[model samples]
Target: MPHRTYLTTPIYYASGAPHIGHAYTTILADALARFARQSGDDVLFLTGTDEHGPKIEEEAARRGVEPIELCDEMAARFRSAWERLDIGFDRFIRTTEDEHKAVVRAFVQRLHDRGHLYAGSYEGWYCVHEERYWTEKDLGPDNTCPDCGRPVRRIEEENWFFRMSTFQDALVAHIRDHPDWIVPEVRRNEVLGFLEKPLGDLSISRPRSRVQWGIPLPFDDDHVIYVWVDALVNYLTASGAVDPSLGPEAPGFEDPTGSWWPADLHIMGKDILTTHAVYWPTLLMGAGVPLPRHLLAHGWWVVGETKMSKSLGNVIDPLQLQEQYGTDAVRWYLLREMPTGSDASYTPERFLVRYEELANVLGNLAQRALSMIVRYRDGVVPEGDAGGLDDAVSTTLDAVAAALGDYRLHAALAAAMDLAREANGYVEAREPWAQAKDPARAGDLDDTLATLARVLGVLAALFHPVCPERSAELARRLGLSGVQTLQEARTDAPGGRTVERGDPLFPRVDV
Candidate 1:
């Protein structure tokens, strides 16, 4: 049965231009969305920029531009980058949008009405860079912000607070009940370890006098919503679960099944795991909303064992890489090189290795099979059985589905690569060139050529999720309109169509 699969990537903080880190999460979600669609599921893939925060205000002042002006520019850069990299997100949501503001206001108001919110005061160390409050214990040595290694300032302010602590027991119970709610096992245990201590109420508002570039609290005009509060509601806003025009007693307010709420999966880097797994879920509970089905905290892309950071000047701009090696190559390298949910290093040498795998194995197979069909059989695919390779294709298709079901994307690509290798080995064993030289071997040659053509067609479908463009080119060369689904590929096994040989799908790249 086809079902809706709602997936999301964290709305990137719009304080700087996007880098490889940003590309990884969006591309990962894009590949998953593509696979779901090919498998006949309804998918809503959401990604965008988080534009409200003190960080944005500070960055704008340094650049001598209004916060909104800076947001407009940065958001465009992110959108442009995703376009170049073929990120097919269904909705590019911006917190600055009026619709998003309406949803945020309504959500906070619901919390306030239910007594989940209260007036509070706080005096603590605040990290303007992270837009978060940090206790002394969380601060690093020399009193730096633990997350970013930046200086913190002492602030005493009146604010609105959500009754997050009130739900701590329930949250822990839910986590314990659903052990797989947070993925990668290690992250789940991390959140559980944090829960071993007390959970405090979340400070959900800041004074407008201190941070003016945010949504003003719906219940209090003197204060504005905390950036995380406004930012986290983006998932709810895009899910169509909150109707700003309706009151708290509305039917849809209680039952959000009609919309895409309770997202199937939320994808983000490990740095923001607490925001999604803890703060976001408790916030939803307070608003009488259901929590997302799953949370995935993937590791970072590092350089020399250090997380790539713009401050260190180690950030890799994906668009620049795309300019040299097409978008699919960049996508392939990121998805194939990184083990899903684990840190992977970024190096030119490793990238070329993956590229050559494409060039020498998958790309080589396409070149050989299609060119031979054009050369040996007058440009038409010969009709025959899949030449004893039927089991290989079936096994690969099952492996891809199983791996993707577990969100093990690297494993899925590995399965497909193995199939490509198997096809190459089959080519060596059959040796159609020798078969074509003898009159008595005509039947054997037809079966060999048919088998290669069939495998190439299947490979096109298997690789479509990770490398859509390259797969489409291969499908076109196989005389198909475009890449097909697993079902379509299994049944169509290239035969009786004119095949065209084109340039290699992935030409070898030199360092």
Candidate 2:
């Protein structure tokens, strides 16, 4: 059986429209999933919207419609944007689904029965935007939400409380023993710092009078589940582990069971470190489920040193950008410009710069090499000695695979780009243009075209995860249909096969 890799993107909030930040996270998850699949792993990728919350309810009331109506419209927008980007997620989970509600109730009831939950009355600083309670000490100097820096309201209510404090020490030790559990050395340390403070019991529900737009606690229908708790269970709920009905049918075998439990990776923005790193693990331990193997916290995108927001009138729409440039071009920009676990600046100028390299470097190489094959070798991929190109291509592939192994996306892209640059240099050195001058030098020309084809093959396979459509086109152009693996890349071009060239994969764009 292939190694199983289950991963998830932090579900986008349904209260807002999809933006470039959401697009970036989804694309990153998609690329990682694609890489795992091409590396011969059984991969399950999940992404979706968090549709229940007081915010969604308020927004609906203002619009004179049901909260579900608002959620449906916003969820459709996200689905459309992801489809436009060609995100091949295995499952797109929405919290409003009936199966999801069942899973939430069942999971929470288990926690209640396990003595991890109890009834309580509490007064605290609550951030509506974050759906979290902040202690007086947890608040910023301006008395705002520490996470989002938004104002908080003081609220007193009777609700169910989770015994998150009980497992604090265990979580800290687990993280220390397995430092890689939380990625990006910086984020790991931040979580440790947060743990230095005593852990507090979590308020785990909202009275119906206070907020009613969530799953009802299984034991008590008068209170709705806390938004964070409801949202966190989704990771397990969407898998076939906790609630079979909630999970979609896994493509291959029947009854997936817990094969995908203890997820391989949970990809989220750095802002949610406490939720995934602390609350999630403690909740899992309380319910007797193993912790996810890894938590990767990535950075945010800012527009010219300012965070993009609607009130600020500066949000970047992902669909508009994709429409302006091809989907792969936009995907390339996201992968190329940002290092994993680092903030990336989003600007039209920076986008065009990265976009140029795709059209000029990779695009130019493919067009020149294949056009030569057709002109000099009758469009047949010849198996002339790959020459030094084999070592060059192989080395780059190793570098790319290594970088991907560590989740260094920008580095992986750089490794692939280096191979493209070297191939271009090899073309210049061989002067394939001048080599074709002699009709008698046909064998020598075949050897040159052969090496170029092999190099292009490796590039297409290596880049397949990042830019699927263009990479697939290039793979077919090299006479290797669906050639998406490293092993397949090596054995491509069995010496004398015809291939076709399409219009330019990325037409050069004017900045």
Candidate 3:
């Protein structure tokens, strides 16, 4: 059976337009999913909008539109942005979907039946901006919500609370026993430290009289489920945990048990670690659902020393970037430049620098090498004597494979580029232009052209996942057929076919 891998980004809250931060997370998830597919894994990638919340309702009211109408409009924007970026998600689940609602209700009801949920009066400082109730200590120095930087209002409302405090010790123990489940040691330490403090019962439901834009509670008619509770269920909802067989729509969808019980990874932002690492697992345990295998929390994106925010007027529109520089260029710069699990600044200058380095340096190498082959060898791939080439090319290929296998994508790309650099150096050293003048040394020209074609073939294959369109064009120009797996491309073929020249991989950008 093929190995199964499930990856997800937090369902983005649809309170505003999709920003660069949202695009960053989904892009990272997309890259991982692409890598897994290249590695021959059966993968399911999930991303969507978190449409039901007080924030959505408030925004709707301000616009004199119904909450659902607001959600519908904003959700479409999110979908369009993702499609433009080529996210390649298996399913874009909206929280308002019937399947999702049913799953959330069933899970919450199970928790209630198991005595993990109870009626309570929640009196706390609520942040309409955050759609969460914050405790006194959670406030900032000026008594404002830390996330939104706005004064929170103290409100007392009847609601159902999940007994999150009941499983604090268990969660701590789980983290202790499975340290590898969380990527980056610092993130794991942070989760452990948070759990070391007093745990609170999470407010899981809000009174419908106050907020009607959420999933209605199964046990009560006048209350709706909290947004976080409804939102977190998307993980299981997309995984076929509810209504087994994935609601009768998925092919070969079986009851998610045994091998499919727990998710392989939950890719989310560091801001939501508390929810994913702590509340999500505890809630699952309460409902007798399987805990996820891993939760990899990544840091936020900062722009010019400030976090990207709509209110701050520093939000980078992903569509603009895609429009200016093609989707693959945007995708390549993000994964190639940013070290996973760390924050990176987004700037036009930085993007331009990386694009030129990659497109001109790495991309130009393939173009030049293939052009030479077509010019000299009549568009036929020349054969290479494996014993004649330098050992450096083989060494670089090995290093690239090792980095890719270890999930060090930046390092992998670097290694692949190093091969391109090596090929360029070989061309310079061989002086193919000088050798072509003498008909007596025609064999030498054949050898030089053949070596260049072989190396370009390998580079094209390795680059396919990063800059897919450019790589395919490069592969075609090199007279290669079909998608060449990394393994096959790395090997030197003695009877290789001809090379064909094509358009430049990356067209020059104005800005």
Candidate 4:
């Protein structure tokens, strides 16, 4: 049976504009999803908008529009951006959707009935910008929000709280027991360190008068489900797995039919690690549903020398990038630039550096080989033995598989680029163009072209996850319609099919 894989990006907050941070997280999740699918997994990729809470209500009121209207507009922007980026997401959930609200209600009610929830009055520093309450120790000396460095207003209210403290020990043990539960040793350590500290009970609901644009609680109409609770439940609702009426075996959440319980991974920006790594798992555990297999938190995308934020007037609109460079170019740059769980700078220079890799390296290699094939062999793919090219292809495939196994996306991409470099070296050394000029060297020329085609075929398959459109085109030109997985890439065996030369895979961008 194919391995079952389910992954998600945190449903983005719809309060502010869609920035590059949102794009980066969503794109990364898309790439990982595509990789799993190409690797022969049954994958579900989920992303969506978090359209509940004070921020949305405030923003909508400010804009003189209904909350749903505001959500609709912003959600469309997000969808358009993802579409332009060629993100092949399986589901795009919205927190305001009835399906999602129903699931959130059901899940929260289960937790409440099971004694995991309680009504309480609270008073503390509340970051209205973040819609989260913080204790005195968490606030900066300036009394600014620790999260975004903005001023926070003090607020007092009665709210429903989740028993987050009860799961501290269990969560720590789980993290220790399953080291892969949170990706990259650094992030895992961060979560464990957090667990070492005392965990306060989580506020799980907001009074409706305070935040009128959210899902109302099943038992308490006067209060709505917390935005975190409503948003996090999306991963479950988006799966299309729940019957809404059927309750699973309390502890196991068993889906013998494999209908999407127990997510394989959730990919999000590092800022929300605690929410995902801590609250999400405990929430599931409290409700007797199995925890997700992994939570992968990736770093931020900052502009030159500083983090990109709307307030800073330095946010890079992803659409502008897509308009300047094509979709595949932007997608390739994003995936190839960032090391797993590490911050990456998105400056013009850095963008060009990645563009060069596409235009000067992979694209250049593809154009040269195909053009030469057409000129010499009349576009018929030449035949050769499992020469050095096979070893190179095998080595490259192994490297990509190994790198991706540890969630090293940058390393996986680097391995593919290395394969391109090896192919370029082989072509330069052999001088297949010179060999084509001599009648006696005809056999050598054919073998050399054949070797190039084989290597290129493997690359096309290998890069299918990162650059699907270009890779699929290359595969077709190389006569590899059926080759999809890395395993298939190794044995593509190009020989008899007719090849065609096309325009450049990636054109040079005018800087």
Best by TM-score, which number? 1
TM-score of each: 0.98, 0.94, 0.92, 0.96
What is the Cα-based lDDT of residue 45 in candidate 4? 90
- Candidate 3 at 174: error in angstroms? 1.8
Clashing pairs in 4: none
> What digit string (tens of lDDT, one per residue) describes model 2 on residues 24-112?
88999999999899888999999999988799998999999999999999988888889999899999999998877887787777788
Lowest lDDT block of 10, candidate 2 = 246-255
Q: Of the pair 2 and 3, which is ahead by lDDT?
A: 2
Where model 4 places Cα greater than 4 Å from the true spot, the runs are 246-257, 480-483
Indicate the residue-level lDDT of 106 in model 1.
85
Highest-scoring model, lDDT: 1
Displacement of the residue 100 alpha carbon in candidate 4, Å: 1.2
The sequence of per-residue lDDT tens digits that candidate 4 reaches over residues 1-511 is 9998999889888876677788888888888898898878898898989999888888889999999999999999888878888899988898888777777887888898789999999888888788898899999868999988888888788899999999889988999999898998899999888888899899999888778888898889999988888888888887666656553322224342446767888998888998999999999888877788888899988787798877788988888888998888888888888887999888889999999998898999999999998999889887765255888877877888898888888898999999999999998999987898889998888888888888888788778778888898888887666546677656666778788788888987799
Given candidate 4, what's the lDDT at residue 181?
A: 86
Error of 1 at 56 (Å): 0.9
Which residue pairs come into collision in candidate 2? none
Candidate 4 or 3, higher lDDT: 4
lDDT of 3 at 345: 89
Candidate 4, residue 298: Cα displacement in angstroms equals: 0.5
